[model samples]
Target: MDIKDGKIKIAYLSQVPAPYRERMHELIHQDHQFSYDVIYCAKLEPNRKWELEYGNYKMHFLTDVAKTFRHNNTNVWALLKKLNPNVLIITAFKPTMLYGVIWCLLNGRKIIVYNDGTFNSEKSISMIQKQIRKFVYWVASSFMAPSKGTNDLYNSYGVGNDKIFRSCLCVDNSVFDNLPVRDREFTIMFSGQIIERKLPLFFANIAIELSKKIPGFKALIIGDGEQREEMIERLKQNNVDFEFTGFLDQKILPKYYSRAKLFLFTTKHDEWGIVANEACASGTPVITSVDAGAANDLIIHNINGYILPINVNIWVEHILKLLGNDNLYNEFSINALAMVAAYNHQQAAGGLVDAVNYALAEKNKSTQSNTITA
Candidate 1:
């Protein structure tokens, strides 16, 4: 429990490439009191090649495990035991999480489970998976949720108030920085996977409406996914002035963010869209959906950005407001940059450190109390 001097060993197990993992590693490394390790459970078929590469972490392939359930569950535990981590953190309650909880419970290791969004939504995940996730939520020692909505959802599912921690998603300010004070253009940008949930058609519709009204109005669509072809065809059919950049690396992503006058996020079921944070970090005012977790926490209505319901008319009105008033654009831009500071890497890691310290302190107190009673 005396983590002040004790060298804490923590491990992160997740399939996706966590952007904040390197920053977390660096923070822990610089601090002489803690040691951290990451075991990335990566898929084998088509590799997820990160542009801004994260080094200083161990990688484990999940190919063999993918073949069978027995292999996945048993082998992962063997790997965890070999690592001998003091605290195990699972990013999601997937099959990997089931293995993590079982192993941690058997070996008496602390477990932390993270869920960024509402896991039980009919549009997001299957009913069967949601039921299993509920069980996982009940067993975790601590839960790290990326948004207020997600934290509240877990609490609604019977997770203790103390066990649930609010750790919102953050952006690396080094990669995405404040935009320069220049003549803001009549350009709107939408970045992220072109999927059905993102409501790309809505962005296309906004582009069609705004292009006719404002001169030189354009929409920039970045990233590619299953819905890319459909979105492109829709844009062409509507005869909209939009640029489709097919998948960008983290290094090259800044160019897209810097060029845009405003960022439009229209995700229908996103738990906490980190792209919104990236856009805000770039000093571009954002128009995000009320459903987005980032919007719930970071956006302060007319202060930094606008949080509107899923309606293109409202989006068009907000876009026109930004284009018409340069003074208002500048004001929102300044506030957007200031608002994203609390969601930076340092703040996120600081929260993690505090959570670990709190959990360990409570654990030690309970142990001492039990010893006295015995």
Candidate 2:
């Protein structure tokens, strides 16, 4: 239990090597509080197009022999056994990770469940699935959450507030600073996959409606997916001035954010939208859906931006209001940057360390109690 004597060995199991997560893990390694190892199920998920570089921390990728795998495979068990870490952090709930949880239970290793799911996003869970999560909740030593909504989710599952830790979902804020200023050519922007859940068509509809009121209104659409062609067709038919940039890399993505007047996020359901952080860091206001998990923590209603339900007419009205008033737009933009300042890589790393230390101490107490009874 004495950290000065020896470091805690931790195995952080995740789905992919996302750039934002790698940044946080790099900071955790620099802290030198624990021997941290990041174990990824795969190098990248099929749906993602991020170009990732591994960080300074120890990383292990489970071999996915199956050519068509969803998230994980059975190889996690062998790698976990070989690592034999003192603590295990579970971020995904695939069968492989479920088995890993069982393995940790048998070996008496502490398990911390890191989740981003909110009450709104998980409202439609079947009874059997809810029971499964309830079991996992009982077994986990502690929980790590990003927002108040996620905290409410754990509380609803009967997990006490004391056991929940805050590790805000964040990105590297440095990348978004001091960029070359460009003309705000695009009046509105939508940055995410063009699939059904992201509501790309809804964004197009809003843009079409706005163009009718504002002269020469232009929109910027970033990302590509199965529904890209259909969304593009809709915009073209309505004579909406828009440019579609398909799947931008993380490095140059901020350039577009800087050139846009506002960001529109209309996801049907999202645990956390890191894009909201990027837009705010660039001093751009966000108009996001209430269903997004970040709405509760990142976006302050009427301060930084407005969080409203997914309705075309309502969204169009807000967009016109913000664009028409220069003073109000400047106020929202300034407030946005101020609000997102706390969400950075260093703060996220600190939160993770606090949770790890707490879990280790609780596990030690449980061990001592069992020994005394024996």
Candidate 3:
């Protein structure tokens, strides 16, 4: 378990912003058995704050390639070769998995590719890309997906069940553990990008209906995206009492989780919403769509939270039920907090370490058996 002298070196190649990359890096690094390094393909210069905070990790800021191409073939293999990582894990499919699988095969390094889920029907890749992804799945030593749905997607591409493992997204327990206990204000909070897919308008409408029934009913929308202006205008037009925080700092987000009575996740389709985990960790129960990846994993319908259809009217009834019944709300909140323990950082890190160990052991056994045959 000794991490010193780099017992296990991990190289993560990502084009995403620093917050996500750094969070994953820190989760892995916390384990004494692993030493992690990140190769960030800076399509845009990282936030100054991110650079200042993550200054210690080995970061490669490249501007030559566009984000799409970087995800596909960003010379991550060249960097992987230099790091000589014992285990290589690629997030998302396509170019990253495609390149990482080839590099690991050529170099005899163990590889695990993580898929939150395969691309949605609307976002499905080209036939050529699907063929390439199938090949990547075939070559990878193991595959780690965040949800059963994602695992099924990998299997659909001919990846064996043994090669695929579920590693659901997680939150740092410490962040939630320290959240200040506050009175629930009978408010529902929706904290994700304002996009058509997320169906924020549905939640806004439900909130408007609930406000008429329950005096203190309100909704808080936190995040901005393509539909921000339109959503804002709609909210104003409807005269819904809601707070638009735009984008709040991660440090300040726990407070919102503490204050809200319920977390409303209206995404009609999501691979896995990590914000659901954040909500649970903050001791707030969530009312989420059955379509969310995390909903299947974390939410026990009527136990932890309700998993309702994506209909606004149905959502309104569920909200009113929770508002009128204190026992139901308290029960959900308590159960939700208890459920968060399973998705804590320690559990996730342990799952990753176990997956890596199994992949490495299988590789070693295969090598030794070949030597014996020779």
Query: TM-scores for all candidates?
Result: 0.85, 0.92, 0.83
lDDT for position 305 in model 3 = 86
lDDT of 1 by residue, 280-341 (tens): 88888889877777775887788878999888888899888876888998899888888888
Per-residue lDDT tens digits of candidate 2, residues 1-374?
22323777788988778777877887766655577788888776667778867778889888533244456477888887887878889986777678789889988888988888997888898898788789988988878888889899999999988788788888766677523224688889999999999999999999999989988789999999999999999999999999988999888898788778889988988999999998998889999988888996899889989999889999999988988888898899888888888887666676677667677874532211110000
Provide backbone clash counts, one per model.
Answer: 0, 0, 1
Q: Which residue pairs in candidate 3 have backbone atoms (N, alpha carbon, C) closer than 3 angstroms, thus clashing?
A: 72-95
Q: Pick by TM-score: which candidate is best?
A: 2
Q: Model 1: residues >4 Å from true position, as ranges?
A: 1-6, 43-49, 58-73, 119-131, 177-186, 362-374
Candidate 2 residue pairs in backbone clash? none
1 or 2, which is superior by TM-score?
A: 2
Candidate 1 lDDT score at position 284 = 86
What does candidate 3's lDDT look like per residue over 185-278, in tens digits? 5388888878889897887777777777777566788887778888778777877787888877777766677678788988878778878888
RMSD of each: 5.6, 5.2, 5.9
Show where candidate 3 strays beyond 4 Å: 1-6, 17-24, 30-35, 43-52, 55-73, 118-125, 177-182, 362-374
